[model samples]
Every structure is written in C-alpha cells, then in structure tokens.
Target: MSWTVHVGTILHLLDPTANPRQCLDRLWEEVEKWTSIDGIWLQCLPGHLQPSGTVLVGRCPDNADEIANLASPATASLNTDGLPVVARQLRDGNVPVALILVSHHHQPQPAGFLVDALSRYLLDRLRLQLEASELAEENHYLRSSLTPQVMQHDILTVSGLMETVIRSAIRTAPSNATVLITGETGTGKELLARLVHSHSTRSHKPLVTVNAGALAAPLLESELFGHVKGAYTGADQDRKGLFEVADGGTIFLDEVGELSLEGQVRLLRVLQERTITRVGDHRCIPVDVRVIAATHRDLSREVAQGRFRQDLYFRLNVVSLTVPPLRQRTEDIPLLINHFLQKCNRENYKQVEDVPRKVLEILQAYPWPGNVRELENCVQKVVVLASGNTFHEDLIPPTIRSYINEPHPLEHMSLGSSHSQDSSIPQNPLDNLRQALEHYASNAGPNIGECFHHIERLLITHALNKERGVKLRAAKLLGINRVTLDRKLVEFDLDVKRGIGVIEPLVDASES
Candidate 1:
C-alpha cells in the first residue's frame, strides 16, 4: 500500500503599496486562482492604517500558490502582495476572519521531503499573517478538539459549555455525593450520569441504570432493592437488585422526578443507610455504591407541589449540572452541521461538499425547541434526502419553517395599549439600545464593531427586501435619504448594482 501524505500550502502577504480598492481586486483575483490548491492563502495588513479599507488580504491554497509561482516573476511579485492586500481590505471592511482548514490526501512522491518542507514554510507564513492581521479573534477549534472524550454514550458533541460541565463532573465524580444532571428531554441526561460513573474511581465496577418512571411501584421496589425467593407470586428465584449489583460502583436513577412517594421513601432509605434488604427477607445487605440521578422535570417545583420528595431532591442535587440548550450557542451550529454531514457521508457512501448558505441561515434563525437531539434528527433527515453535494433548503422540515415564519407579537404596536405599556415600561430607549449593543458586543470578540456593521447591513437588506428591492422605498423605510442609503449599501459591502431578483421572503416579515 502506498503511503499517503497530506500537503498544505499557505501564502501570506505582509505589507502592500497598492490602494485599498486595487488591493481588494488583486486579492479576489489571486483567491480565485488558488481555489484548487491544497492549502490556505492569507493576507496581512499594516498596523498603522485606518480601519476603513477592506481588511482581507488575498488567500488561496498550496495549489494556487503553485499556479501563482508558475506565472511571470513580475506577475508573481504583484500576486505576493495580493494576499496581504486582501487581509488589509477585510480588516478595513470589518469582516470577521474565520480560520478554516481544508484537507487533501495524496500519495507521496520521491520529492515528498521537499514538498513537506515547503508546506511547513507556507503554514508558518500563514500563521505569521494571521498574527499580523488587524483582527484579534481567537481560534478555539484545536482546544475544543483536545477536550477529554466522555463515555461515547454520554455526550454527542464536545461544545464549549458541555466541555465545562464534563470537566467539572469529572472532578466531582470520585466523591460519594449524589449528582444531578438536568436538561430538557433528549438532552442526554442519562449520558451525563453514566459519564460521571465512568470517570469515577469505581471504573472497574458495574454501573446499573434504572428508569424510575418505567416500572410500577411494587416492581420498581423489587428491581431497585432486589427480591428474595417467594417475595411475590412470580418471584421464584433469588436475585440481586440494582443497588446490590452496583456495589463498589454506581447506580443511576433516570427520570428521578417520576418516582412515586413510596419509591422515593425506599430510595431515600438506601441512600442514607448505604444498605438494602430484599423483599420477603429481613436480612440487610451492605453495599458501597455511588448514586447518580438525572431528571428533565424541575424537581424543585415537583417538591414544592408535594409530588416529589424534598429530601431526595436535596440529596440528588449535591452536584448539579445543567446542559445548555442548542439555541443558546448558535455559533456551534456550523461545527455540528459539518460533523453530522461527515457522519452521513461515511455511512451513505456519498461525498457532499457544500451546505448551502440559506440552509445555515435558516438553521441559525430557527429556535431549536427540542435542542441538540432535534437538530441531529434534522441533519439525518437532510443527509438521507440529499441527492447532490449541496443541501437544499426545501429538504428542511416544516416545523423549522414554521419557526422561521412565526410572527413576533411584540413587533405590532397597538396604538391604544402603546401609551400605557410605554408608561409602565418607562421607555428607556437608550438603555435598551445599550443592552442590545452589549449582548452583541460580548459575543462578537474582536469583530464586534464589524459584526455590528454586518447586522446594520442585514437590516438594510431586510428593508430592501420589504420594499421589493426598490432603493428609494427601502431608503424611505429606513429613514435615510436615497444617497445615504446608497453609501450605506457600499459601506455594508452589498452589491447594489446586482439585480435583487433572488431575494427570499423575509423570515421575520413582521419585524422587517
């Protein structure tokens, strides 16, 4: 078998002498040429320039570098500055810089050493360019990938918040304190319980998991604390209960909120005494086991309602962990999408290159009521239905479409109630504006200001869409003059000259 070697080429341009407009034009040309290369192309900007010009320097892969190098030396010299100029343009334009890795596999040739060295050189140059670039957004992909793997069954993805939870759970797992993993249904509560057990000191011991809500009172009692022969009409043979079986290990009780009062009493006894007696037999058996419980229902509320035991709730919640909903961190959507797509490709024996921008936009905009599990199901459906490299928006489920189109009641201002509501709410438009700005600011990293610019552009685009791409109407709706809107269109980096024939219906039409 021939050994495969992966080659990566990265080109970096440091300082350029050309004007911003010329720089951007040159950068786009170079990026187009390097589209087929097996590496990334990068451009850097000078530190002293104002943050108004396009910040992106030119970028292409190794293959593109080869093509550029093959050109006349005079042309290559211009091409060399091309990458830096693009980086400068992107910085000035305030576009968020996303570092992406594109991989390729090829059989090594006799000159592999030279090629490999060149690749390393290119990567070094790219890193230098990235450092010198005006944007300071940090990369988390590598750090995220290095997170300790949980039990394969426990967590589906190692997202930032999930990683924090897992790491915290690992540290607390060895102790005998009861662990409560809380989240919405299908958010992997049981998985977190098992992960706690697997990482605990009792790794070699058994882990017995029971669904507290699945069994009737009598059966659940026998299943948990075991039953002696002739304990009940059907009990003909002696059997160890979950607590007994989990000796020196862990016993996980899932859906703990569903446990009846009687069941909770028995469980509380076992937890407090560290011993259990089989039904129909008076002899108590001592067992050393850690208890990890999970629940989707709000146990505190259940306790308040007298449905669940308060003592049991307090015991189980010794170490509480809450899994964040997928909607809370929309930034992870791309990573999850790529992960699911790769899995589908492997299983279905199909190669898919691109996920259409519209599909991602819909995904980001939709509120995932069922969280990650629902998102995974949607991905599976898309993969099964996909016939080409691109995933079409039509393949998305109607439920997601409904979410995207759902009207916001707040958007409509009732003239009668507006005054009273405004009085009660005390119209602090400046404070509300500040809060919104801060929320976006905290999440946007170094590209906060740029991201804001993009958001403003998006708002303008929405206005244009509402007016059916009529510039005058859009400008009027936005409360800006046509000339001002035209300048804004350019500032937002929108293509004003292109016909807006393909604009989609505003997902949030009421808001628009």
Candidate 2:
C-alpha cells in the first residue's frame, strides 16, 4: 500500500485520546502489524516552553535500544548512520513536538515515508494528551477554589432576601434535617442543594440528583427503588436506585411536587423506615442518606387542594429555603451579569471586561421572566459577540433589545447591511457550512483532508457563535457533548487563537 494510505489507516488504528506512552505503543504495534520489521523507537519533544532535557522517549520497549539522543533534532532528522534508521521531527506552531525513529537490523524496510507519517500522527496526539492533562489540572484547581465565600460572593447574591436565605442554608447545612427549597424555575434551587451537601457531614459522599417530575409512576418507582432481573420486560439485570447509590451520601430530589401518589407512598416509606426494597425483590436494604428536595411549586397549596399528601409534605418541609427571582431583586442584575461575563469569558476564551452603562440599564429594565438563567443567557450573548473589552447595543439579543425605545441597529444598518431585519442570529447550520466553504475556497486552496477539517472548525465556530458561546448549546447544535467540543476547540486552535469567522489553518490536516 502507498504510505499515504498507511497514514489514514494509522489514524483509524490509534486511539486519539491515549497518553504519549500509550499512543506511541499503539503506533508501534500498528506499524509492526502492517510491516515485517524489528523493534522501533520514538521520541517526543517537550511542549509549552518546557526544557529540552525533559524531552520524552515516546516509547522504548524494555528490549529496544536507546538511540534517540545520538544527535540533535535537526541532525537526527537527516541522520542515517549507525543503526541505519529513519528519523523525522515534527512541530506545532514552530515548537518541535515529536521525533520518530524507525529502524531494523541491516535490512531496507518500510523506512522513510512511514517514519514521517508516524511522526506527524504522534505529534498531534501527544499535544492533545499533554493539553488534556493540563486542562484537567486547571479544572480541578478552578473547582477546588470554589469556597463557600467565593460561591456566596459570586453567585448567591447581594440582596437582603438572598442573604437571609443563604444564612439559613449555612445554619442548616450541618444537620440531617430534610430541606425543601422553593423558587422560580431558574432561580438556582439546585445550587442551594449543592451548598447544603458541600457543608453537611456527608460532604465527602455522593450527591445524587433526581428529577422526580420527569419520570412516570412505574418508571419512578423502578428508578428510586431499583429492580431485580425480570422485574419488567426491560429489566435485564439487577440495578441500584439513586438512593442506594447515594448510601452514606445525600440525594437531591428535584421537582418533588410532581411525584405521583404511588411514588409518594414509596418515598414516604423510605423516609420513615430508611430502607428500600427492589422493585421485584421483597428483601429490604438499609441505607443512611440525607434528603434534599426542591420544587418551583408551592407544596403547601398542593396539599390544601388534596393534589399532594399532607403527611409527605410535612415529612419533606422540615426546613424551607426560597430563592427570589431576578425581577424581585433588580439590584442583583448587574452583579449577575458581571458574574456570568467572567464565567463565559473563561469558557469561550474572550476578554470582555466591561458592560456598557446604557446596555446594563436596558438589561436591568427587562423583566427577565426566565429569571437568572435567562439573564445569564443574555450576558453570554453579549460577551461572545463583544469583539472587544466592552458591550454594545448591537450585541444584545433582539428579545432584550425590545425593552428600550432607541432604534435597533438592524433598522439603521438595514440600508446596507445583510444581517436579517428581524434578528442578528445567523442562518441555519447548513447555510453556515456552505458560506464557510465558499469563504474558505475563496481565500486559500486546501486538499480534501484540510477542507474537511476546516469545515469542522467552521461549524464549531458557527455553532458557538449562534448559541452565544454557550458550550452545551453549541454542542447540542453540533451533536457533540461540551467536553468533546472543548477538545475540538483546542485541537484546531479555534478557541481564541482564531477569532470568530477567521478561516486560517494553523496546521495542515495531513500533519494535524
């Protein structure tokens, strides 16, 4: 087979997410499988300005010879003496990332093209592994730094009502009493649950969250009290419920108001007895767990109407905490906007440091019917499209822009601009891809591989832009998860390195 075909086959054979040592081993194995050759050796250069002495031996089997350091990278690339080896050094944005050395005992083998192809493949995978490690560390640091003070300062609130709620949460977190949190849909009832779990004695254990409202009666029973094999048609194996999984931990049952009468009886039995029986089994399993429930509805009123059982209501409402909606506390709007701005900046890799005064006024005036969640969406919109350190009137969504009397930018720019008259949102994904392709083809010539990679990068960019840099929404648009999208952004240097709509290849696809 031609070496180019081997290159493509190599990608399919190797795991892209493997670490340097693992990837190198897989590469060596694949190469050995496809070619009859003696053992091989590989080297990976240090990245992110790390030391040259720290350059890694990508893979050196216990029996393989150590001959990678015989010469410098430049000399190593051209060297052919001693072991009669083929070597290649590959770089990313000018920093050497890997060196490949494929050799055999005095025989002319699949030597030259294979070494170069392997070097390119190994380089990209190594960078991904290293970046993944670094990102993991960074994320852990960010998470660990979310102390109680920071959580309260950043997200809880500046309102006296919120302060009262937070104070109650703090005082009640250390106890085992059941907590019933009430609030509007987007007012962060889940956050309150987390705060309680983090401070309780069970903090080290799991916090299993269940949306009780989403499940039907039978499914809810089976989910809360797991089933044995053949409990139902779909019961293929024995399973554990969220409560059992959360043994010695806390279970946060969200939207408890929606649980049916039968589900309520099962839950009440668990709360009263601290035991659960599998759906098919009569044997009872004991558990030690704390319960935290949240609902947007008033459970008391439901009980008064006989829609909810008073006994279950009294069992769950031992302690109550309510979160006020954004409209009730307009003073917190600016603080929340800034808070979301910082968060989205880190996520989308933007540097928006300021919110314009007039824009803030318009945002504050809006009713924010969706509560803090909607306000956050609005902030994310402005931040992603800001293009600078401050916000502008044009960046605001039309829904929010409708609050004021000033002429919309679309109306003024309608004379010449091609943006939609109704909204600034981009067209459908297919249109975005077509326009991106046309733009890419107009600016530079790309091979099939490069063309495909460019299209992927553009779609990710367009999806992020369309969703206002909300990674989850953008991922939904691209049919990928947020983690996958993050990896793609880093892989292609699309995060901040290439600004929105810029079509430049950081590395050739064959090499990437």
Candidate 3:
C-alpha cells in the first residue's frame, strides 16, 4: 500500500503568521491523519533561543503527560512503553538546533524514514516563518527609534516656546490685525508669517513679500507705495507697489526696521487710513490689505533710539509672535536632524539615512547663533560631503566640532561617590591647569610658553570660524578688543580667507 501527502497539503497545515505551538498543533493533525503515528513533537535544543521546549501534536492523549516528558531534547530518542521513537536532528551547521520526535507502535515500520524526512522539511518551513517575524520586529524597532514628534503646518517642534508661537499664529490668523514677528535672522520668522497668511481669510488672494532692508532707502518708498509715470528715474510707466499688488490679500514686510523715517510715516498713515498714495501722485488708492511685518531687530529699541516710528511700531505690534532660537530649544534638535537628513538625501541624490547618537550630542551642545537655517545648511553640507550612509564627526565643520572636541578632565572622572550635577560639568580653570601641569611633568620638558600658544591659536581659530570670519564679531565673541584680536591673528599666522572667513585649525607639531 502507498502512503499519500503533497507539498501544498503540508504548507496549508503550517501557518507562517502563527506561533510555533499553533503551527505544530495544526501540523500534527495532518501527520496523524496520513500515517499510523501515535505521537509527534518538536524538541528544542541548544542555541535555538526557544524557551518553547516541546510541542506535542499527535494521539495518545490519555498518556500525553508521560509522552511529553520523554519528548524533550534530553530524552527525545527514548521509546516509552510499547512505542518506538524515530528522531531527526535539525542542525544549524554542525550544532543541533532542534529535534523532531516521532513515536509509533508497529513492528517493521516502513513509514519511519518518510516521517523523519517530513519532520526536517517542516522545521525548514518554521525557519522561514521565524526569519520573516524577526525582520518585521526589527523594522518596527527602527521606526520607533527614529520619530518622537511629527511636523505640524510643515513645522517640526516639541518645544513649548515654539508651540505657543504656533498656537498664537493659528488663533490670530483669521483677523485683519497686523502681526509683528520678531526673532533672530535665521529663526524662521518668515515661515510663521506664511503660516499666518495661509490660515487667514485672505489666503485665496495674493500674498506679497518684500525684503525691506535689501533695497536702497531712496527706492524703498516707491517699492512699497508704488510710482506713477515720471515719478523718478526709470519710472517710465504706471506702477503698483507691493501694497497694491497685495490688495485684498496679505503682504509680508521683512526687516521693516530698515524703512526710512519718511517711509515709516507713510506706513503709519496706510495703517491708520487703509490707503496709499503713489510717488508723485496725490490720490489715495484704497487698499483692503493685511500687513504682516518681520524683523530680526528689536523694534521697541529702534523706537526708543528714535530711528523707528513709535506710532508705526504700535500699529504693527497689534499681534506679536517671537520665535525662540534653536539653541534655546535644544530638545527639538534630534527631530530636526532627521527631518533635514531625509530632505537633503532627496535633494543631493545621496543616501545619508543614519544619524548616530554622538552626532546628536555634538549638535546639541552647540550654541547655534544662526538658528534653524544654519542647522539645515550644516546638514545639507554634511549630506553632500558624506561618503557613505552613516554620518561621521569629521564631516561636520570644525567650527561645530570644536565645542565638543575640547579637552575636559571631568569627562572620565568617577568622582568617588559624588552625586552632585556640578561634578559633571566641564573641567574648571584650576582643574584644567592642574591637568596641563601633570601632563607637562610627564613630558620631556616644561613647555609652558608653547602650551598657552596652542590654546590662544585654537580659540582664535574657533571663534573666527563660529562668527564666519567677521573680525568685529569674532573679537566680541572671544571677549577681546580688536587690536588684541588683530595682533593674535598676525602672531598665529591665521589667514582670513575672503568671502566667509575660513580659518584653518592651527595644530601644535609637538602634540601631533
């Protein structure tokens, strides 16, 4: 007589999505149906990582407990009472990973070899399911590790300051009141302006933008209030300004503090009367426009300094939104890093998908004076310069790396049971001096003169890089006067390259 079982029939018995216990239970029913099997079980062996020791699936339910005890890997090949045991070892290389145990109660069993072969095939099928399950688990772990927050209105942030700014923008968007947005130059004031306009009643109409500081003070008036034919040089035809263009919509005036006193008076009039008069024309053109102004300068201070109009400042400050700088909101840096990583990957035709934790720490410690825009530019440069998928410390500019790369004695200290948080801060001046003295003691000589030289050069170079090579700014950042900074610059032989102040790090030859 010929026994019968097909491959598809066996596959249907084992569900890959189910646990091994469920798979074995379903598989055993098929085995007992097609053969004269009394019992069958899978026994776990060493290195399987399977705490699921044995799965019994066949008949002999009355003596199931006794049979299961014998089915474990230690007693897998033992026959109990009148049953005979036939086993197949599942080997991963030379080591046994599992044992497929089968029991029967007939002499001269022809199906014994066939059952062993079937057990091996079933175990292989289980291996496939295990591999797939592991892959799914790994993907989920990766996604959880990557995202802690989501972007709202294309703005990704978790900081309370930023959330407050966004909430204010949303709450104030529906009104016609002029909004004054203030922040550092790169802190995304214009983005908040667009957010306000997009959620406003005037969203469907044109939204005009002008860089109030980026124009000549003489021409700024014509640019905002427009010019008629023959109003001035190059005024050959009738022209409408940004206010006219943005009528019935919203207009964003960036760097509004740069507006001249004359321009400020006209702006205040337009705010008060809802009308504008063209240059060389007296007729007031009524414009139903909402103005949103932004500035990196302190308008209140500008007003106090008498350079800006107080009335205009008050008119524009009906609603105010101040964006916090990135350094103040360091908690959001990780989310921003991943956001820019994926964005730069698509734009640069690169695949820098990995951002390790050390990179995050280094970036977090930085006082990003330039804010979000600088971070995005840093990430973009890193993506372009990346040689592989992972980001490395060397790819980051020396200006940023210097903050984290500095020598600190407290970094490795055990503190001898001190629990105070102050112990974890960077090495103090005295501690740093002691560390240098000890190091020099262990060296060939006392290079005290050279030690100070290394520090001065490194600091000057770092400051120049951080300030992007502006001499006055770098000197201010370093807490030194211009003459001292210039003298040091000459002494260190630090060349200030044109167009962005690139200064190479001056490494000591002895240290190298």
Candidate 4:
C-alpha cells in the first residue's frame, strides 16, 4: 500500500550546478512529510546520482541536444538519455513518476523548444501514471466484487469449463477477432460476453447489446448499421446504429443465430472490413468495434441446414465458448438455491430461514428442463409463499413434488436379506409400527394414491399407539368422528383394540 513518487528535474544551466542538487534535496525533505507520499527522487549530474531506500536519482537531459549526446554501453544502464529513457524508467517503476523541469529562473515562458519538449515529456509521464493508477484501482475493485460472485455463478458446477472459456476469452479480448458464445438457454452466455468485454482493452467503452431475435430483418439491419434521413417512410432524421454507437467498444449480438441470411451477410462484411454502410447512404463509415455474439441455437447445425450462412458462422466463431447447463452439475443445485433464496428475500423484503431437507431433496430429484432460470423462478416462488422459519414441502412447486416421492433404488428388501435382518428388532408393537410407518412414509412412491395411502396408514397407527389400544379414544385422538375411524378400522380389516393388546406369540411363550 505504500505509494512512491519519482520526481525528475532537468537543469538547463550549468552555471549554478552545485545549487541544483541542493534545491532538489531541500524539495525532497519538504515532500517527505506529506502523508500521501512515501518517497522522492532527485536527479544529480547527468547519469550520476545518490540513492536511498526512500529516495533515488537518475540522469535527465535538459535539452534535446544534450539528450541525443548522452548514451550508454547498455540500454538498461541509466545514463543521460532523452525523454524516451525517462519514459521507459517511469513505466518500469511500480509507483507513479512525476517529471519536473528546472530552468535558471522562473520565467513566464522558457524557450519555445525547451517548453515544448518538457511539456511533451511531462504529458507522457502523466499519461502513464494515470493508466497505471486506473488499472490498479480496477483490479482491486474487481477482486473484491467478483470473489463472492464466483460462488453465485458456480451454480453450473462446471468450473473447469467456465475457467477454460474465461481464460481463453481474456487472452483474446485485446484482439479484433469476433467471439461467439453458445449454450443452453439459461446458461448465461450473455454474462460471459459481458465478462469478456470487462476484461478487454475496450472495457472503457460501451458494450451495446442487440437482441437479433426481437427485431424484424429490415429493422435489425438498420438498427445494427444505422439509417440515413429519407431512407424509409418513417425515417425522419439520420440515426446512428449499434455499430456506430459502440465505436471503440464491444457490440454484443445476442441471439445472433436468429439474424436473417442477408443480415448475417451484412454483419459478416462489417466484421471483415471493419466498416459499415448506412441503410441509405452509399458511403461506408469505418467503425472500430469488437463483436461478441451469443446464441442458444446450434449455429453449426443452422449453417448446415442453410438457415445460417457458413461464412458468417466462421466469421463469428473466431473464438467459440460453450456454457454448460445446470443439470449436468447436480452438486451445485443447493448452492444455487441458496443464492436465489437470498435474492428473493432481498427483493420481496422477507426473512426466510433454512430450506427444509425435503424441499432440497425435491429440488435435487427433479430434472430441470428450463435450467438455471427455472430453478431461480422456483426458489422465488417458494420464498414468496414461505411463512415460518423453515421452508416446507408444501412450498415446492407441484411439478417437482412427484420426484421427491419417487422410491429410492434400495427401497425393496426381502425379510431374510441383510438390510431387513439388521432392521428387524423384537420390540413393543407400537415401536415396530412407528419404525415401519417412518420407512414407508419416507419411501412413498411418486404415485399420489400410494403416497396418500402410506400417509393415512401412518396417521392411524400413530393415533392407535397414542390411545393404547382403546378404539374409541384412538378415534378421538385422530380428530376423526368415531364412526369414521370405525369404518376405516373395518376397511383395513384390523381390530385396533385387539391388535394393540396382543403381543408376538414367540415373545409370550419365551416370557412364560
């Protein structure tokens, strides 16, 4: 966090050579007390100066002739060189560098050539300083902002694929090549485009996005390439298109595969020539723009089917990236669910606690056809409906409920099998019934009839256990009219009172 400032002074007159260093030293002493500054620099004679941990020196020429004459055996060796050497050193330093040109006196204007050279040199240094500072600040900010987002976007759980694409995109962002991002519809292809733009040299400029699918062919072309006045009936005044507006920046073409063949050809020509001809004007206006295209459709298949031009496909696919769908990474579902729940809570101004284990199981079991977008919507719905601290099964969308009831692969077991043998423990009838009910309830089939039957049996068994075999009391405990419980007992062909009093024949004999 230490900030160092390099100050270089060029002495034009040699008459007061001894006093120049003294003046620089005094300036350094004064600047040292400034809290923001960590260090200072004082240039002694050309190519020679003292060095300190907090201060250093270098050779600075006062005029172009002096600069031209000073040279060294090796370029790395600092000598009395021209402004180029100073510029190189300033760039090499980690901290900001400032150039101060000292004349014999504080004249209103030094000689024009001297003033011009000094001004140019100072400007160059200032530009470098600004660029370095901007880059540092941006890096720091992005690290803080994007570190947490990595978890949010990691929902796809395809970190390897995403990392490869991100790294490749970053490497190619500075170049003029067009990038094509292809993926399933909710896989965040547009987000990837923004990421590329953010890391590119053109990040300072606007990233204009155009949804090709939303616009008609003619309008799409005009929107992308601009239209001149009187080009059409509705054309009132000259208009700048996306390409013109996104000059020196990136133009993100979303759903680029939806573009008509003719539009694709025009876009291809623009990419190839780096120029665009307005809808009406015959003149071609050169545009400097980076093209980043995204599409959910399979462009290659579209090209093969003659829907998309092969040439245009090749032009746009200079660097292709594929974002993986969410289902492929089941492990990330819980993480994504949490992120969506938090987002919903913030938007709706509600406090939601933990997602119930049953709800999570339901979410994980269902095959998400709409991908991440569907999952996000599902979470929002649950958050909206949630009342208590814990989200319950009732909050889950009906479409996902069946999956949660689907029987596990290990549900069926024979009585003599290892699983049944370990689970079978001689115990009170109520205890055995409770265990059986728990198992059946947890393994309820996806069929609603089967699930309902399991739930009703569990409720009856629990009530009977609580009433200790008293049929009338058990019926009352279940909150059912006595006649209804009596009908259920007869329907199940079970004498609730007798069954509860009876013990296992083997256990009774052993006790005797």
Leading candidate by TM-score: 3
Off by over 4 Å in 1: 1-159, 344-353, 411-512
lDDT, model 2, position 43: 25
Worst 10 residues of 3 by lDDT: 1-10
Off by over 4 Å in 3: 1-149, 406-512
Q: What does the lDDT read for residue 163 in candidate 1?
A: 68
TM-score of model number 3: 0.53
- lDDT of each model, Cα atoms only? 0.59, 0.64, 0.65, 0.59
| Per-residue lDDT of candidate 1, residues 1-512 (tens digit) | 11123333433232368554454444445544332323333333334322222211223322222222222222222222122211111111222122222111122123344334434545665554544331222223422553455224356554545667778888898788888888887666777777788888888899888888897997987888889899889899999888889999998888888888998999999888988999889999999989888888888899888999888888788999886666544545666676777787888887653665556667865657787678878888887888876566888898997756554332332212212321212122222334546655665668766557634654566455333344644555566666898898665555432113114321221233
User: How high is the lDDT of residue 350 in model 2?
Assistant: 94
The stretch of ten residues in a row with the least summed lDDT in candidate 1 is 84-93
| Model 2 TM-score (2 dp) | 0.50
Query: For this target, which candidate reaches the highest lDDT against the unseen true structure?
Result: 3
Give RMSD (Å) of candidate 2 vs. truth.
21.6
Ranking of predictions according to TM-score = 3, 1, 2, 4
